[model samples]
Structure formats: C-alpha cells, structure tokens
Target chain A: MSGFIICFLIGLGGSLVYLLRRKKSVKEISLFVTFSLLGFIVWLSIFLGYKVSPDRFFGWIIDSIGL
Target chain B: MENARISGWQFFLLSLNFIVGTAFFVRPGSIIAVSKQDGWIVPLIAGIFAVLIACLWLTLASRNPGLSIVQICTKVAGKYFGGFIALLYIWFFIQLAGWVTRNLGDFMKTILMPRTPISVFHLMFLIVVCYAVIKGVETIARTIEFLAPLVVLIVVVIYLFTLSEWKWERFEPMFQVSTWQLIKDSLPVIGFPYMEAVTLMMLVPYVKSRVKTGLLLGITVATLLISGIVFVTIGVLGVTRTSHFAYPLYIIVQELQIAEFIEHVESTIVIVWLIWIFIKLCISYHCAVTGICQLFRVSDRTWIAIPLVLFISGIAILTHENIVDNIAVDTRYIFQYTSLYGIVLPVLLLFLTWIRRFRKGESGGSA
Candidate 1:
C-alpha cells in the first residue's frame, strides 16, 4: 500500500512539474490535475477496501431498466 | 489538431489490427461456447453485419469531411445538447480503454505471469500506450502498418502447424443449431469487435482517401481471419474442448509439438498478440484523448494523456471482480450498452445531419 502511494505521488508530481515546465495553459493544467486527483481518489478507495465495481453499478442500472 | 494524416493502406492495417485486438484471444471461446460446432459461421454473419454498420459510420463521416465523430456531434446537434452527446462518447471511449487494459492485465495474470499483480500489467501497458498516443496518430499508424503483417503471418503459420490435428467429424453436427439460436448467440459477437469498430469513426477523417474502401476491406479481412481462426480452432480442439477452455487458441498453440523439439511456442505467439493489443489500446486511448481535447477546446493533448493514463488504469482495476465477473457482465450487458454508441448515436447523428441538409436545400431553392 505504501509503495503504491509513493509511486503514485512521484508519478503525479513528476507529471505536474513537466507540464509546468512546458508552461501549459491554465485550463490544461487544471484538467490534468483534476483527472489525476480523481484517479488518486479512486485508487485510494480501492486499496482502502471501499471497492466500487463498475460492472455491478452498470448491472444495477441495467437491471433497474429491466434489460 | 497537428494536421496528422495516414495513407489509405496504413488506415486499413490500423483498422484490421484494432478490431482483431483482444478479440483474437478472448472472443473465440465464448463464441464457441454459444454456437458450438457452428461457431466458425458466427464471424461470417457478424462480418456482414459489421460491414453494414461500417456503412452507416462511413456515410456519417463522408457528410462531414475531416470532422471526427465528436466534432460532428457538436456541429449537427448544436452546442449544449451536442456537447452532452460528445461527453457521453468521451466517457465511452475512456471506459473502453479501461476494459481493454483490464483484458490485457487479466490475460497476463492468468496465463503468462501468475505471480505479478494485475495492476502492474495495467500500469505498464497503459504507460506505453500513453506514450504512443501522445506521439499522435500518424506514428501509431506507421507502427501498426509495420506490425500488422507480422501478426497475420504468425497467426496463419500457427493455423497451418495445427492442421495435423484437424478432425473432419467435429463438424458433423453442422447446422443443427436453429437459426434463431444462432442469431441470438451472435448478438454479443456483433456488439463486440464488429459494432465496437464504431470507434474507428474517430479515425475516419485522418485517412487520406478511399476511407470507405479501406475501412470495409479491413473489416472484411478481419472478419474472415477471425472466422478462419475459429474454424481452425474447432477443427483442432473439436467443439467440446474448444467451447470449454478460456483461451482455446492458446491451448491449441501450446499443444503443438513439431518434430518433438519445436514445442511450447505459445510464448512467442503471445508476443504477437501483445502487438495486436498494443495497437488496439493505442487507437482507443488516442481517440479518447482526442475526443477530450476537441470537446473541451483544450490546447494540448500531451498534458491530458498522462492524467488519463492514471484514471483509465484505475477504471481498469475497478471494473470487475475477476475474469468470471467480467465475462458475465460482457455476455449480459455489453451488446445493449455498446449499441447506444455504435448503432443509436451514429444513426441519430446521420438522421439529424440529413434533416439539416434538407432544410438548407429547401431554403436555398425558395431564395
């Protein structure tokens, strides 16, 4: 778990630094950070045992519709 | 955005590799399970259906030259509604990328390297895919153009090497399955690799010319090849075993013992499959990234690519509990879900575009 977090931070940080160095536009930077943070939250939830299966979610929706 | 262009031939190869991608390994078993000895015939029917679907997509693309499906959505539907439609497509593409990535991870874990965590495979493969996508479509096209022939040659050679095991009797119960049952079983096949080829609409504008011919021929050839592979697998492994194994093609290759020394060649063939999967992932990932850029009017695709890699990988891991769960969801829901994008959206856009064009024509005549 610790290893995953460290790797995630390094990857996220490194990418941010690279984008900043390139002087990307504000919108581009925000999009990157937004998606990256979303990814982090997802992975953290999965690792912390708050598993959310897309299959089940979709299946539930599909079932409700009676397909 | 970079004014990238791929030649007609390159587009053809890209289309072939993309459709054949993961389906090459995983689809046959499920297909055989449903259709039994008649499994080989499913791809033929599915191929014809796919060509018709491709026609819808091509006509849509032709109407709006040089515009991708995303741009076309916004153009035809107006801003807010079209933007919503485009957003749905972006989500679809990302979800597709996640599924493809998960397919790779699952295959690696189950067959090749059992000890390695599946996430490692997803991360590593997505990282490489991200790099290729960041390079733009032309690089990907050229790369697949070079690799496509090798994949074809290896697959054909594997087919030939297994010929000694072919049994004529395996096909004896041919055509016993009812037409309704056959069609029923074929829905998933159509929805998959065939209908899923709608993603190629994103690449249609990038092809230099003969987009229709290239797209159709690529799909036709892929269909025949998939049919042929299923045919050969049924012949070698027989209907019973073929339907049973998760990776029947791999099993057939593993059983090959040429001259008692030329054996266990599954590993080498896996390298070829990896190429197929890589090309497929690159195209989907590219389409997803490109869709986001065009939809949001973002300046740079490069920055978006890296972050998406993280999000897609998360979805890959979070999508299913395991292979069984994955297969269950696929058989049950994939057709209905994919049809919304593959069938419903393209048809809807095409209808609206025609209506708009007709109104313009009427106004011009009145003037």
Candidate 2:
C-alpha cells in the first residue's frame, strides 16, 4: 500500500505538471496516471506482498482452459 | 526525438546485439532442463519463427514510415485507443529493462563480486545506459556495430576450445521428452530473445534504408548465431550438466584452457557478455523513455530519463525475491506478456491498417 501510494503520487504529480503545460492530448495524462498507478499497485502486490506465485498463476490459467 | 538515422548494416548489428543480449547467458540452462539432449533444436525452431515475426514487424514499420510504433498505433487506431495500446507497450519496455538490469547485477554478484551489493552493479550499469540513451540510439548502434564482431570472435574462440571435449554419447538417450514437452520448452526461446525482436518496431522507422530486408536478415543471422551458441553449450556440457548450472555459457567458457598458460579467460567472456547486456538494456531504456515522451507530447526526454531510471531500478531491485524466482517467472510467465506485444498487437495493427486502407506516404515511406 505504501508502494502504491508513492507511485500514485509520483504519477499524479508528473501528469499534473504536464496538464499545467497544456500539452497535446492533455486529457490523456489522466489515463497515463491511472495506468501507472495501477501497474505499481499490481507490482507491489506480487513482489512486496508475495501474494502471487508464478507456478500458481500458470496453473490457474491452465485449469481454466481445461488444459 | 533525435533525427539521427543509421545505415542498414549498423541497424542490423544493433538488432543483432539486442537479440543476442543477456539471453545467451542464461537461456541455455533452462532449455536444456526441459528438452534434454534435443535442446539444440529449440533455438533452431525459435530462431526461424522469430524471423517470420520480425518480418511482420518490419512490414508494419515500412507501411507507416517515420513513425515509432506508438505513433503508428495512434495513426491506425484513434488517439484514445491507440494511446492506451502504446502505454501498454511502454510498460513492457520498462519492465524488460528492469529484468535485464537485475539479470546483469545478479550475474556480476554471482561471478565476480560476491561481497559487493547487487544494487551497486545495477546503479553503475544504469548510469552508463542512461548516458547511452541520452546520447541517442545512433551512438549506441555504432558501439554495437564495433563490438558485434569482437563478441562473435570471442564466442567462436570459446566454442573452438571446447569442441574437442564434446562426447557423442552425451547425445544418446535423445528424444526422451515427448513432442509436446519439446514444444513447451521451445516457447521460452521463441517468446523471449527471439520474438522480443518486436521491440525493434520502435527502431525500424529510424533506419534510413532497406528496413524490412535489413531487419529480417539481421534477426535471421543473430538467431542462427545464437542457435550455434546453444548447440555448443549442449555439445560441451551435454544436457544434464548444462541443466545443472545456472550460467551454462560461463561454465563452457571455463572449459577453455590454451596450453594451460592462458587461464581465467572466463572473466573476459563475462565482460563481453556484460557489454551485450549493456547494449540490450540501453535499447530498452531508450524505448521506454521515447515512448513516454511521445505519449505525453513532451518535446524532450532529457528531463525525465533520470527519474525513469530510478523507477526502473527500484522495480528491478524489489521485483524478485531471488534469482530462482526470477528464472521461474521468466521461463513460465514471460510468454504471456511477450506473445501479447510481439504477436497479438502487431497482427491486430496490421489487420486494422488493411481494414482502414492506410498506405505509406510519399515523403516518409521506405527508401
């Protein structure tokens, strides 16, 4: 959660700066920030939380596919 | 951002260097672990398949000349949808950069500096790569062109020294793994260092001439060269021994003894492999920075490169608990991401372009 907040703040701050500059596709900066924050959240959950296992990730996929 | 353009050969060497990067350091052991004696064939098939996929990427680039893949995506799809796709690719490039950096740092820690922290190596590496990315892709390409021959020469010399030690009996008990198993083993080879050439889509537009054929030939030659390296690893170490070691290529290099006088040449080989890894990391960093710059309509990436490097370095350090988990994730899960970017996205882009009837313009089309 700390990782997610830090990354989210970073992304939000960066995108806000760009928004102030009124760059082309200024609206897209929000999208970029959202995605960046989401990516950080996922990485944190996997690497920091140790919640996801590679083997289990694949196994679940295989099971779903009935492979 | 920079308007620098490279010739076909330099571009070929750059692509070659990228394709044969840190992959050769570790892929052999994983493949051998799966296919046993038939590990040699995995690279052969993967290399050939990579050629076909690269040809697709080149065609897409040629059709939409002077535009990076991100730009091409925006042109083909609308701004919103295309920008979303481009952002995904940006993440892929950044993630790949992190992985390669971690691989290099881990390797140096294992072989050379057991006491030194891995973060020190990662920091040193990113500092150099940050300079390369800022100096622009042309500088990196020239370096690769100069270093490519030396890399090939060292590989050849190592292989020659180890040739006499190969035992034919090692190849016996072949075909032990089923065809399905062989196919499974080959997926990493295809999905990684090979199909990962799709990252070249970010580069193809910058080549001055012969974009399609040059990239195709480059990938083909690099793939073949890597296939030979895999074969040599299997021949010298055989399947079981190769699978046992983490750095199989380094072990193969350790076998080199010229008249028992010139020893410890494995250090030299490791240095050369580090150069290869450096070039790969630089290219990935360049892609990520350039993609971000393009995405935000930023005129220059100069300001953001350092922060981006820090972010990636953090990810590299924090992502894996250890090399064992790293390798497990790399071998098993990397295909899911690579297939999406390498195979699915490009095919979708090509299909969309055909449907929309987009054609290359007079000024920007291939020369």
- CAPRI band for model 1: medium
lDDT of 2 by residue, B106-131 (tens): 88898788999887888788988988
Best by the DockQ measure: 1
lDDT of 2: 0.77
Model 1 chain A TM-score equals 0.77
Off by over 4 Å in 1: A1-14, B365-367
* lDDT (tens digit, per residue) of candidate 1 on A22-46: 8888888888888889888888988
Each candidate's DockQ:
0.74, 0.12
Per-residue lDDT of B75-165 in model 1, one digit per residue for the tens?
Answer: 9999999999999898888888988999889889999999999999998999999999999999999898788778878888898899989
DockQ of 2: 0.12
